[model samples]
Target: MNGRMIYLIGPSGSGKDSLLDSARDALAAQGCRIARRVITRSADAQGEAAEVVDPDTFARLEAEGAFAMNWYANGLSYGIPRVVDEWLSAGDDVLVNGSRGYLPEARRRYPHMLAVLLTVDHHVLRQRLHARSRESAEEIEARLARNAGFAETLMTGESDDLCLLDNSGSLAQTRERLLKLIAEHRLPD
Candidate 1:
């Protein structure tokens, strides 16, 4: 199978990370490589491999040609490091559980990238954010507003450049849908 990059984009609290974790596990069992990102955001304080770095350091690295692409989201700077090119060069399908806003830039850089926009219902998203216990009521409201703004930017009609997945239901359903898409696209070996 030809190497292709899959980039995941969706709003905050949209289960992108959880779904990507499961997808990565399944894909690795099949010998595919899943890519990780570096972020300037603070760690989850719950031991997630956040690759945490201060803003200044992240900026320096970006200036030094360390990142393949860099963008800001939810008030944090995120970067996909240049090492991803090496993996792509070696014929690995790079699975990136990252922001949706990166789609246009990634497409310009990696012509074969498959951009998937995962989504959850507004109620489901609010529930997820509440369960995190990381935000005040006011902060949650602000976050939801920001997500709405991002959603607007992403609401264009579909094309080969975009794939939309609604994830407001069970994990099994979401995984099944994802697997079917990957197979249909011949993205995984």
Candidate 2:
């Protein structure tokens, strides 16, 4: 059978990274192949655990057609490298960490792609961003406003299906729910 892609799309402070980390380890234990995304943002701002890629090199890779899908958001450029296509082509499902703004384009490209929107209450989002402290207060407020509008568009988009993973609960609880969904849907791997 052909493989499919499961994309996790959300705002900056919606706990997308944490949820993905937990889900990745759990899915790996069950034999799933999760794909890591490359972004142009500074590694320091992204946190200590993220893989680092130079923005210039990422751009070069894109120009050389190394990415299956790529886009810019929030002043940062993000790309799903062609290596992901190689994996999916080889019958391995790829769990991609992505931005909500790219959902419509992604769906258009891969009609069968499973898009999951990670969500948290606005208050929670504000608090989380504040904790991250990567952006100044004013910048954070601007992002939150833009993120709100982007989230709405993603939620209303026409696609095969849209799954919402609420991230307000404990990390373990969220991971459990994600695992359940993957199994129930028989998402490719």
Candidate 3:
């Protein structure tokens, strides 16, 4: 039996990294492996635990077909190592911190993948972004605008494969919701 793909996506500062970190053990106990991304950024970057690579190295790896999936966003390149394919083939569910813009391509490749959108209340999101201090106030506003539109579209869309997980509350609540969502979508043996 092939394992299912759980594609988790959300705008920056929506707590994707935090949720993944907090729920890592629970997810593993449930037979799910979170794919560590190869990103073109410093190892000490303030975000998810991703493999850091130079732009040239990333380009070379992409050319060599080392990634199962890859895309460029926010001035950085992100890749999911091809090992994920092997994990899924071995009947281990795989979760990826994926991109919203790359959803179409991901869906095309993994037709049965569950697309989970982690959402937060606008005020909470703004506060998180401000606390992160990764972007200027203007940039944060622009991102919030974009997130609002994209979120609205997703919420209203009739996509059966899409799951909306709100992360507006405590990390504990979001972690429980995440685990439950995984259980609910687990593939039958």
Candidate 4:
């Protein structure tokens, strides 16, 4: 059986990292690999475990075909490494921290991949972004606008492959839902 790619996409303050952390812990005993993305931002900027690369470095890597999927979003560069194919071929479910802007291209490239869109309500998103303290008030507002843009852009294309999980209420609830989604796809038929 071919391994699967579970692609996760969400807004900046949607608790993606938190959800991913819980998922990793929950799926630790399973044959799953959660991908660490290559991002053109500081390592600690968003509290996500990503390879921090400079703009020039990111551009060079992109030219070198080091990424399976890559895109520019919110003034930053993000990429999913090419090793994903290897993981999938080896029959291990690979979970990737992905981008909304890159989904169309990503779907074109990995049609079998499971796309998970994690989200929260507008007020909750605002509160979470402010609580992170990583972005200024202006940046937070801009991020909200970007979230709306992503909603419009992501609504098209592959509805069947898309799974939505609202991360608004509590971390445990969202984590359980994510785990079930992963298990549904990860288990052998």
Winner by TM-score: 3
Task: Kindly list the per-residue Cα lDDT of model 3 for residues 114-137, writing each as its tens digit.
Answer: 999998999999999999988899
- lDDT of all predictions: 0.77, 0.78, 0.93, 0.85
Highest lDDT scorer? 3
Query: What is the lDDT, from 0 to 100, of the residue 133 in candidate 3?
Result: 88
Question: Considering summed lDDT, which 10 consecutive residues are worst modelled in model 2?
Answer: 43-52
lDDT of 4 by residue, 76-180 (tens): 898889888888888888888888877777788877788999989999999999998988999999889989987876676556668999999999999899888
lDDT for model 2 comes to 0.78
Q: How does candidate 2 fare on TM-score?
A: 0.89
Ranking by TM-score: 3, 4, 2, 1
* Candidate number with the higher TM-score (2 or 4): 4
| lDDT measured at residue 112 in model 3 versus the true structure, 0 to 100 | 81
The residue pairs in collision within model 1 are 9-100
Q: lDDT winner between 1 and 4, please give it.
A: 4
Ranking by lDDT: 3, 4, 2, 1
**Whole-model alpha-carbon lDDT for candidate 1:** 0.77
Q: Model 1, 60-108: lDDT tens per residue? A: 9999999877899767888887877887777777777677666777888
Instruction: Show where candidate 4 strays beyond 4 Å.
Output: 44-46, 186-189
Clashes of each: 1, 0, 0, 0
What overall lDDT, based on C-alpha atoms, would model 3 receive against the true structure? 0.93
Q: Please, what are the lDDT tens digits per residue for candidate 2 over residues 30-147?
A: 5567776677777667552445578888878988998888888877777777888777777777788876767778888777887888888889899999999788999999988988
